[model samples]
Target: MEILDPQNTVLTNAEVYNIVVEKKKAFSSAPKDHRASPALRTVIYETLTYLSGSPAATQTEEQIKSLIRALSPYKFTGAEILQLINLRPKTAVEVQLVIEECEERLTEEQVNEIVEIVKQNFPIQSETKNSLEAAEG
Candidate 1:
């Protein structure tokens, strides 16, 4: 059997501990209620899993929160905002209006980056696929 590189494996306990400590420090210094909204929390959790290249099931709520805190400066709330924009638009004008509204707070580049992250972390599934189609319809 070939020898595997240790660096290619998962983080060691010490590394994990250090990360947690740093995360706590960052989180403590952040503005209160940065992630107080349920919608914001959901977006933060999803973004953390994507950015870490880790399975969502393996992450604890605290870990998720920590990662969110670390990325606080990004200011955008990941997939949740995308989901909102995807909601049914009664007319083309309405869709255009919504896009215009979103453009004020989020740049197209940021939105595109979030889309790419989602594509990498959560491959589209039948249920998700159908829901998105339904939302558009």
Candidate 2:
């Protein structure tokens, strides 16, 4: 079967999740005897699980895309945006750890902006842990 990405380009994890789940639904409605092969079913299950990110990162994906685009002029891959949405880093160090492979380092201000955007959507749990550490230290 020839598969086409809806965007006519590479898909992000969330987009992949939507497409896979939509296909799964279509398959579910088909005649049971005509359903996907066992191997394909297993692959679908694993893909769903891998893309099912934290329930707390509840912002609509369009919002996430907008946030990622805000970092432009910096140029991030779609995979990086997906990981950023899933991980929700809360500081410059955390953002660096996520996007370290980018050709250029983000300035402190830029990292802070990205962190703030992420925190607005999904505050990483580790931020509280880091806050406690700062208080205790």
The digit string of per-residue lDDT tens for model 2 on 17-126 reads 76788889998899989899999999998888776644322345666567676656567776777678666676778788888653276777887888887777554555
In model 1, where do residues sit more than 4 Å from their true spots? 1-73, 77-100, 126-137
Task: Provide the TM-score for each candidate, comma-separated.
Answer: 0.26, 0.64
C-alpha lDDT values of all predictions: 0.44, 0.68
- Where does candidate 2 stray beyond 4 Å? 1-8, 55-59, 73-86, 101-104, 121-137
Candidate 1, residues 75-133, lDDT tens digits: the string is: 54554333322332333333334444556655666555544443433434444456656
In angstroms, give how far residue 16 of model 2 lies from its true place: 1.2
What's model 2's overall lDDT?
Answer: 0.68
